[model samples]
Target: LLQGGDLSCVIRERQNSNKLFSEVQVLEWFIQLLLGVRYLHKRLVLHRDLKASNIFLKDGTLKIVVIVPGDFGVSRILLGALDFASTFTGTPHYMSPEVFTCSGYNSKSDIWSLGCVLYEICALDLAFDARSWVKLLMKIVHGPSPSLPESFSEELNHILHRMLNKDPMVRPSAAEILKLPYVAENVKVRSLFILTSL
Candidate 1:
């Protein structure tokens, strides 16, 4: 367990945090998560379930949050380098269309789920919602993709749209995502912080 706690606790600390993430703050969180995902991918692991509750944070110094993903109950390590994985796993709200349809999938599925997580972080609401399971599934498979508020920066909106692309092939790989302007810009800012601190 993370010494600080999970991100859900972080979200809970500020009642309206869901509605109030600055672009820089959200980009930093996304960069941290993408780095973690890149580590998992390099090791051929797939964190099938990636949501707010599943992400843990360091215990001390709550000012600068550190995300440590937890809950590996449903995660899997691929036996081969092909990257394809079985379907029908992961939480429905975060599940990609391929998972719902039992179509062949791969690590990109995790990207889809992460997109949903990022969206929730920014919007303070799940990307997909419905009164029932069937409707939820339908919404995920056929409903229009979720959109961010107009207040979000154009770059942030662009990256999120790519992340949430319905077509797995179209979504950026973790590595590719790490290279996006938004992510790269923050990485430099973080590096500057480290260097200056030293």
Candidate 2:
């Protein structure tokens, strides 16, 4: 059983308490998220409805936190490497541009959702907000990508931008994102931190 509850709950509690996550904490969660998504993609699974609320955290031994992606109600399994899902599914706030456009989407769509979750983690708010689904879709399709808070590192900002890119082709895949220097370094650092803590 997961002890820490969903990420959205954690973020909400922190926000209510006027406390924000440190950069290290955010990076650790983000890297864990990417690794989880990478594993899903490698297995030909598409978690179409990835959001902060769907990710759970468990307290591990030695105070380490383990992140798990859940809520697979809308997930699909691709039959081949080039396969894509056309049905519209996923939370509106975290939906990718292609998903909003009714175009076919692949694993990259999940990456876009990951970007939205990451933004929410940093800002404690949705990246795109509107009174109606129509306006929300318009903002997602034509609006400028939301910027990370000034306090976040520029490297993170860059990574978020890449994931939120309007063109799915331009967005980096989960594996590609994990290979990024910043993400890779964080993975290594997080590993060392966990190891030393134990």
Model 1 misplaced stretches (Cα beyond 4 Å) = 1-3, 16-19, 59-72
lDDT tens digits by residue: candidate 1, 1-198: 236677766666644543566667677778888887888878888778787778766742222222223533677778776867775777789999888888878888889888887887677678898999999999988888888777778887888889888898999988998888777878899879879999
User: Residue-pair clashes per candidate, as listed?
Assistant: 3, 0
Misplaced by over 4 Å in model 2 are 1-3, 60-72
Report how far residue 20 has shifted in candidate 1, in Å: 1.0
lDDT of 1 at 81: 65
Reference-based lDDT, each prediction? 0.77, 0.85
Residue by residue across 40-153, what tens digits does model 2's lDDT show? Answer: 889888888889888878772112122224533688888886998999887899999999888899999999999999999898889899999899999999999998888899
RMSD of 1: 4.1
Summed over model 2, clashes come to 0
